[model samples]
Target: MTPAVAGASVQPDGALHAYARARLADGDGALGLAVASYRAALVQDPARVEIARRSYVQGLESGDRALALQSAALLDQVGMLPRDGTLLMIGEALTRKDWAGAETLVGRMVEEGNFAFIAPIVRSWIAIGEGRYAPPVIDSKDRFASLGLRYADEHIAFQALARRDLAAATPAIRRALAVRSSDGAALRLAFAGQLAAQGAKAEALMLLPVGSAGFASARVAIGKGKGLKAAGAAVTPAQGYARLLSRLAVDVGSDKAGGTLALRLARMATFADPAGAEPHILAARLLTLQGYAPGAITEAGKVPARSWYAPIAQAELIDALAAAGDEPAALMLARAQAAELGAEPERQVRLGRLLAEAKDFAGAAAAFRAAQAAYAPDQLPWTLLLFEGSALEQAKQWDEARAVLQRAAAMAPNEPLILNYLGYAQIERRENVEAALELLKKASALKPQDASITDSLGWAQFVTGNVEAAVPVLERAAAGAPTDITINEHLGDALWTAGRRYEARYAWAAASIYAEGDVAARLAAKSKEGLKPEYAAP
Candidate 1:
């Protein structure tokens, strides 16, 4: 009912429509709705500098400083904002108490200055909360000290709160408020200890949420649920916080470290805010821990239920399951997420692999075929053939496996994994011992310290009637992998063939302990029967 509305009605549908809605929502004090609409508007007019700037401001008005900062970053990504704008956006986001928008921002700001000013101050408050000294960094480290502006005292107080230095934060707050009696900046300021992260269900709190809903009830139990519960009703931001952290970890290439951290955070985030992506992210992590393949593919099973990230998570989770020998589970998830995941090249490759892993060779081939037809530069088809061959071989369909593998080898001649697997399979089947030996030798050269490769080399040598040479190679192979029954057995056989019956008996005896299943049991029984001495020892 304002001029902006009148102008919007006649304006062609685009960014302004969304902005109008945001303005309406803002007037109503529907902070969450206003934030959403403004963002939607900004997305449509990404190139409009004023719109981009206003988008961030609107976010702040809704008490979602994180989202506001993120809008600034999006503009930065499009080269719309100046460096100072980026710095300012980051600064504003970090100084806030409510992190409802944290799922969108924070990291961009942290990188601007390594949080030299903010981190220490927050740490100071955290220390005070637990009865400790404000760190040297708080007293002298923050770069803000260099700025020496009127807000220096307040900056220190904020940093202390960020660090959970409640006592230090309290004094700084007093000094700051005294200096600036009516600053609107402190509208939603929550106490330091009251807003610290509380494990899975209770992530780092906003410490300031006078505007919208907080995840006070919905909580997760990342790894330390009891500790989280102990801090109940206090901290607990939006559910997306855990997923945001998880995504950031992948972005920064710190997966192993990130994975551990994500799992803990996700448990809390998912529990605290199940409506968000936290659950899906957590599910993805759980699947990874449960022996699924690594990366995006093995993360579906651990996803919190009903999350939008479910399809993405499923794609990753299925691949992991397939790689790890959980074929059935992989197939089920792949089928479920196929429509949503098929568009992604990596997901397509994973889908193909899952089909093959499940011995649905036809399905695997079709997936690969589709990926190939799509002309995907990543080349899912080549890997699909390898998987198809493996599935066929597993089913004792030798000819089919051989055909598919040969094509795969032709397509990917230099790939070590494919060459090694094919050569090893041929060796086991007694089809091409010489070729298999050559292939395995190449693999050994590529990986000299690999015990399995060394063992294969020794086996090949023994089969080729080079017993004298096989003995030392097998001995080294055994040394590299002392617990390998195959290596020990090969050494024993090589020794036996090389006229060292006594040594051969000792080697076989050693092998018996490491052996298992039918072959091991048979070998153990045979060794127990005592071999006839090749000619009675003198």
Candidate 2:
């Protein structure tokens, strides 16, 4: 008998041993080993629904579908399937063409008071499989109901195309598109396919949007006289099911329920259409959102080079690498893709960000400059300019940094972060004290709760000889960020200037705990001898 079939009768001590091993592996980030240990633990304690559920999630996150399925079976046996688990089982049933099983699972989902938001979409899939269409009830006040109505219309369009009812499909498609611009990619693709089926290849080509770039190969296949049926659109039940599932996955991923179920749904969509890069990209994004960076990288890396989504997937992989703290590898990969980076200003910006994170400030500044040069004047956003300026500042190109920052400030004068950074830089350099004070005040007003901005304001006041006025501001800043070395040090300075000698020494000692090198030495000297004449109150 397979491990899935084995009875749960092992001793408690044996189960505990396996569970401890699983916890150790998980803490070490040996996720594959952790999954194996979890499975072993579950086998030793088959009645432990918590262990089975955890094992199932680990299996899904690790891309071990077979293990996930086995765990799902165990969860079912123990009556512990959650909404997401029910969706997984339903997807599995749909993949196997077990329509009755999927319908039963859907009913179970509804009774559990879960997935009610997406029930209409699920029911539509069922209706499609049963060779019928369900008209969605539109409730403008209810967000999910609105989504259901839009999705129902799109599915109806697919049904119309399947039955060669182009006139009926066109209006339905139009209504679906009118619902939301973001949700129209699949609808647009399906409509284009239907047009191609009706011998309107030129019209279909014109109707294809940039979002349909992922389906370029399929479009080309259609143009070469392959019918919609041959190209895998709405011609067959399985193809239609895959397309619907892919769309549903996108919807679910963007919803408030979060990405766990969405990842599972996207995984199923990939199984339904392994040739499509869209589903893989969706799965990768959902995996990233779920904090499975390694899994995200793997899924994104699967997109073939010829597909339009390949570049997108590659970018996502780079982000996942950075998220996973493999910054050196991310930098190398970014450099390797330099040829592709030239045309993609956003990619260049991302490379700059990675370089910045790696502390290669000079390289980061150069990358930001390249991005700036590549972007059209109208395309340059304030954030990009701010990043370039920040990178230049870190690289110690002070003149260029100040100039770029001034330009960014001009563009986004009300941006608190920009105001704070620029103000702090000016104060640090002891240049234009009044101007810095004005900027800091503006920033403080915009974001009254920002400790850094508060600290800058107080530090400026202290440096400018307003010892009494600085005390309260610095105290607030210190209270908000008690462990922050700079804030603590500033608080110590202000306290000393206010004649609170004992408190100043105490604050300086606290600051010294987290300070380093020059700051640490300065705090130490201040703790022993008080503020020097230059820093002393007038």
Candidate 3:
């Protein structure tokens, strides 16, 4: 359109100079200008959902359903929004009786792990709706233990009543009671309007504890809902109370319990309000920490595109996918946000790394090219150049790789990682071995803890014909990185060349398991012969 003309368009200010000036046709409400301006900005960058978010919120407050829907779609497209929107969106979907849409929204969030905390509650509703009278979550206890509140408590109560096991329901009801202690009220509420919905009367008669107005409010809301609408409205205020109970449970639960609780809460948030990004983020992070890659991705998927948390959630998702060896999928997700994301160079670098990890060298090369283009005017540009060199070297483009690496080394001479790798490469090619040894020495001093650098330094010592000196250093490097195939093989080789035959055999034997390339095979064959034992530990 024109430019972002806010409410004060009389003269012309910051926004009017932007594309939103055309949207001024919406008239002069506080939200009108912002909506117009943001939409205008979106026209310039269709993938720019954050700007559309401003329009969406303003549209919602202005009661412009169409505009709100548009923005909401944008949020979905961009993948980040408040969790509160979960309740609002699903509630509206239910109001229109759009079962498919509701299912898609709710199910997507659950699958994405956004509603981890409230998952049990949502599952309870779904099960109940499907006529499963007593559907208690096996995971509920652990989750509730963390949040200090168990949605399963309600389910267990209902299940006990279904089985006529009032006694079994006692413990669960008791737990809910600890949330505020109202005896049979929580039990009764759990049994509302279903087949064998016991405890309903008891719940109606239940009152909140003497103190805690918020708790009382929530207790009443839960007691009042007969169907889903009332339940939906009831959830907003109740969540705060539940969250407070959750905080109480934070220390009360173990890490496993907390993880369970986080998952349930995320599910509940998604089922009830699909728009909340934090719950999804929380779920994704928890799952990631727990080493559940698929679960983490599912949780991250709950975020709306318009959220401020979108980038963080995306970054986490990408990391998880990469760690899980699903680099291709990770690249797809990250690339979509490349231009708009804050750490443009970082994201590009990450993408390049992922591509390399996947063995898609050409794709990695392309990624480095794009990343190089997006590099910020800072240290990152230099960093990207290093990454480009690495990628090129991996693809065996030695000439290009060498040129770039030389440039990188000169630009940031202090970076030990690059220096060690480049210097080691030069030694391997037998080109500039002396210079390579010098660089490797510096690298060793810089990162004494780095096994690779130590190995490189030791390798250089051996190459320079200092066999006796290489023995101890190579051995040390091998021990430090026991699992490293290269270090083991090198140590074994150094031992043999130094006439430490027996130790060489043992070293080579160990190396066989962890080593790669032709050396490992060669060592394996030699170790089979039971070479003489002249080697000492020195």
- Report the C-alpha lDDT of model 3 over 1-538, residue by residue, as the tens digit: 3132334344343433333453443343334455566555555544545456665555543334455566667777656755544544654554454545655666765655545555555444444444455353445355434441444465454455445565775666566556544223322332332221343434433433322221333344445543323322222322322332233223223366566444433433343344544445555655566555665777677665543245666877887787667867788877765545233555666777777887877667777777666445464556677778888888988888889899888888988988997898888787898999999999989999888899999998887888898889999898898877778767877888888888887777777786666665566666775433322111
TM for every model, in the order presented, reads 0.47, 0.79, 0.48
Best by lDDT: 2
Q: Where does candidate 3 have its weakest 10-residue lDDT segment?
A: 232-241
The C-alpha lDDT values of all candidates are 0.54, 0.73, 0.59
Q: Is 1 or 2 the stronger prediction by lDDT?
A: 2
Error of 1 at 295 (Å): 18
Instruction: Output the better candidate (1/2) by TM-score.
Output: 2
Instruction: Write out the backbone clash pairs for model 2.
Output: none
Q: How many clashing pairs in candidate 1?
A: 44
RMSD of 3: 22.2
Listed per candidate, the RMSD to the true structure in angstroms reads 24.5, 5.5, 22.2
Q: Taking the tens digit of each residue's C-alpha lDDT, what string does model 1 give over 383-498?
A: 66676677677767788888878888888877766777788788777778889888888877887788877878777777777777777888888998887776777777778778
